[model samples]
Target: MSAAAGTGAKRPARRGIVLALALAALVVAVFVGANAHLVYVAVTSQPDCVPHAKEVGIDGAPLRAARSAC
Candidate 1:
């Protein structure tokens, strides 16, 4: 009687642990999938170099630049 009750209680606890693990795995899979898509885009996409400010001989000033891959 008591042993059966103890076993029954353990089943729900085990189920809860399994459910939590499955949820965690789902979240991890989604994150990895999205990052994988972003990496694929970055590797396969190319952009034309439009005209931009290429100022040089300036001290501590930032300038926009693009690769000459038109």
Candidate 2:
């Protein structure tokens, strides 16, 4: 009887482990999906990932050299 009860007690622990693994898999899927979306947007929306020199600079001054990166 005690042996049967011990096995029954382990069932909930096994369920908890399965639930944790499923939750972890869900989180990983979300992260991968988000990263894929970001990559898609980056690749599809740009002629160049690097911006134009004028866009990078302000009023003919190099932006980063003139100002501290905030």
Candidate 3:
């Protein structure tokens, strides 16, 4: 009877651990899927950091600053 009680207690503990792990996996999957599109864009597309690549002294920061000044 004592051994049966020990086994029963362990079953719930083991189930709880498994449930926690499964929940964590689910959350991770959702987070990754949500960001997958942005990840693909960043990886596959070349970021237009420099607006005028040929023009000397032209930077994105200046353009962004000019736009925000409005």
Candidate 4:
């Protein structure tokens, strides 16, 4: 019947739209997850002020061995 044929065609279009939306959501989730990990590392990581063995008199050298509060 004509109605059955129209409904069948619309079903495929609706499925395609749903599939596209799911794929887009998956991409967005992956991107957000990666950025979240980077943010966490940046927040939780601490900087270390290591003394250079050879280059002692550098302009920005630390006066003493100390841990940075980065």
Q: Which candidate has the highest TM-score of all?
A: 1
**lDDT against the true structure, each candidate:** 0.82, 0.77, 0.73, 0.80
* C-alpha TM-scores of all predictions: 0.74, 0.64, 0.55, 0.72
For model 1, the stretches where C-alpha displacement exceeds 4 angstroms are: 52-67
Show model 3 residue runs off by greater than 4 Å: 41-70
Two-way lDDT contest, 1 vs 3, winner: 1
In terms of TM-score, which candidate is stronger, 1 or 4?
1
How much is the lDDT of residue 56 in candidate 3? 37
Error of 1 at 6 (Å): 0.5
Which pairs of residues collide in candidate 3?
Answer: none
The C-alpha stretches of model 2 lying farther than 4 A from their native spots are 47-70
Better of 2 and 3 by TM-score: 2
| lDDT for each residue of candidate 2 in 1-50, tens digit (9 for 90 to 100) | 99999999999999999999999999999999999999999988744343
Compared with the true structure, what per-residue lDDT tens digits does model 4 show for residues 39-62? 999999877755453344566664
* Candidate 2: residue pairs that collide: none
TM for candidate 1 is: 0.74
- What is the alpha-carbon lDDT of model 1 when measured against the actual structure? 0.82
What would the per-residue lDDT of candidate 1 be over residues 1-70, giving only the tens digit for each residue? 9999999999999999999999999999999999999999999988766755556435544665544553
What's the candidate order when arranged by decreasing lDDT?
1, 4, 2, 3
